[model samples]
Target: MCVMSRRGRFQRGEGRHLCNLSGPPSGGSASPGSFLPLRGIDLKKGGRVKKPGRKALVSKDPYLRLLVKTYKTLARRTSSAFNRTVLKRLLMPRRFKAPISLSKLIKHMKGRENTTAVVVGTVTGTLLYRDMMMYVSTESRRSSDSAGEDDLRVNEVPKLSVCALRITRTAQARLLKAGGEVLTFDELVARSPTGSKCTLLRGATKAREAEKHFGKAPGTPGSSTKPYVRSKGRKFEKARGRRKSCGFKV
Candidate 1:
């Protein structure tokens, strides 16, 4: 029931016209009255498809660049042995506390810088310590007793702990004031060689608390510095007096 005529074509007593949605198709339909889909949608694919290109990383972000710079600076200034021994210990599982207080850890580490204090020390050859809570532990003093007499030897453990650092509002302003930006959690955590987002963040919090007179509030969701946010029942808030703000150096 279809054929071309003076007024386009007729199909089932309905007048329909041919159309080209794209410029690619070659053959023309016989009826010219196919009306269901309006035609020509498939014709534009080849020519209109976008060519792939290289994706630019977010390295351009000032905060990201600063994170990288800070990492290099600290790594260069700090000892590999110290960083490796202390940072790795802190990063260990079940060794750190969540929502950790920064100022306290820094003060404690600096205060006990000379002593082999284990913020993350354990009796099982692991370390665990919390400055804010005045907590410290280490491999239980290795003790040896000579059966021959009342002679005893005490093996003192090495004070192999990180020196905590604290960054106050003035410090933050100074860092950011000079065209710098605060690090979001991810970036700060990334500073660690392990790429552990959480451990490094907690370590940073502990480190920053080392400085004297250092003070700032915690972080909240929607904060510019709040880096990690998972959708589907998880979201990070960026607000004042929140942990994410002051703990980790961004």
Candidate 2:
């Protein structure tokens, strides 16, 4: 027969065996029909299933795996937060390792001169100023060229000592031409075991093309999110609630 306890728990007593419908009662005998005991759950351990994090490197690259191993050892040995952070970043996936350009790196390194700049991703050769000028118009480029010698300095890549996982050939050439040094992770560790006088930098996370289509639904009022339209032609998504003549716009 089932009996409700003072605590409002259902307790079924069948002969000498007791079954707890909720869980084992405190200081009470073990219930034969308790699911918690069968599932091997300990109430003392906060019984919620824990979500796991990456325990090992997912990359097939032997060098990257070795790097992770080395950092793991470093993190275990050193008390520096820098070593721990580098180890965590090194274990991240490729998409999280966003590439940083020389122009942006130069801008970030300003006022923090002579410090080793570390990036856990690729160092690209794309010039931000030149790209912006080109995107503006051909006339703007001509005007920029005719501006002055001072204006030309914006295009000049500066000499920088950078430590990164990978560096493009174009970027490497530019750095070398400007008397810069590109050091590997091992070299960086050898120089500063505790990561002293080092500047950590990361690429723009929201700069990806896919990020533009992520927020609020398209066509909603005040929504700026891009729609997953097949084409950009006029016959596409431009009708019904999109125009004043189309049965009143949304």
Deviating ranges (above 4 Å) for candidate 2 = 1-53, 128-154, 245-250
How would you encode candidate 2's per-residue C-alpha lDDT over 109-213 as one tens digit per residue? Answer: 998768999999999987557546544566655777787433432477777899999999988988888898999999998999889999999898778999999
- Compared with the true structure, all predictions reach lDDT values of 0.36, 0.81
lDDT of 1 by residue, 1-250 (tens): 2334456653332234434333433686544344433422233436566655322223355653453455454556766454444434333343242233333333444544433222332112112243323432322222223233211221222232221223345333332433433343333334444333222224333432233223442243334332334542423443334444645432
Candidate 2 weakest ten by summed lDDT: 35-44
The reply for model 1, stretches above 4 Å from the true place, is 1-24, 30-102, 106-192, 195-198, 202-250
Residue 147 C-alpha lDDT in model 1:
39
